[model samples]
Target: MATGWAGDGAVQDQIDATVEDAVKRARNQLKKGPGLTHCEECDAPIPAARREAVPGVRLCVACQSAHDEEAAFSGYNRRGSKDSQLR
Candidate 1:
């Protein structure tokens, strides 16, 4: 049962929306087209194995790691919980 102003199944709807957003984000991040032999950011050579493993690979391992680290922190909270909104 939903409390206060929330309608029935509101929590489930929120959960499903969050999951859908995550899925869309993941899909958008997927690389497309041909893989590059060199790292676009560092100009380092990308190994053949990596190119084969990750189709449309652009960055070398080091650059990709750095990129991933940079993208790890997300300031926006998609869930928009009451506690988070208060802060």
Candidate 2:
């Protein structure tokens, strides 16, 4: 109901915004078509197994790992918890 200074529905607003943002990010990360034969980032050949396993995969395993690591520090408070804000 009331969220003090934020007023009514503020928490819900934040939740909705977070969910929308996550959906947008997920959509952006998804590949539009079949996986590439080579890694887009490093120009290495993509393993057939990986291509089959993950449709539309663009980066090879090593590049994907590095991308994942970088994504982990994307500077967004994905969790959006109060504790995370405090840190």
Candidate 3:
């Protein structure tokens, strides 16, 4: 479903790349290390389960959801990443 100069599936490829980019970001956080016992922003007690589940997590579930939403709004369009390859 490529819509630009790229051949078929370019759009889908970009989508997959975008998803991969997000997953990488989350994975990078894990690589850093687990977060503190309390929430970084609110100081709420972080559950042991969450801490064990996702290392290097900064925000609690509620805060993380908000943070993710904000990040989604801030993401730059990657259309050029593919189009640039054409040249």
Model 3 C-alpha lDDT per residue in residues 1-87, reported as the tens digit of each score: 436878788778999999999999987765457667888898888898998887776778888888888877845556778766666
Candidate 2 lDDT tens digits, 1-87: 555789687888999999999999998987776899999889999989988889899999999999899877866778789988898
Which window of 10 residues has the lowest lDDT sum in candidate 1? 1-10
Better of 2 and 3 by TM-score: 2
The C-alpha stretches of model 3 lying farther than 4 A from their native spots are 1-29, 75-87
Clashing pairs in 2: none
lDDT of 1: 0.91
Best by lDDT: 1
Q: List the residue pairs that clash in candidate 1.
A: none
Model 1 TM-score, all chains together: 0.56
Ranking by lDDT: 1, 2, 3
Question: How well is each residue in 62-86 modelled by candidate 1, as lDDT tens digits?
Answer: 9999999999879888688998899
Q: Tell me the lDDT of candidate 2.
A: 0.89
The better candidate by TM-score, 1 or 3, is 1
| Model 1 clash number | 0
lDDT of 3 at 43: 85
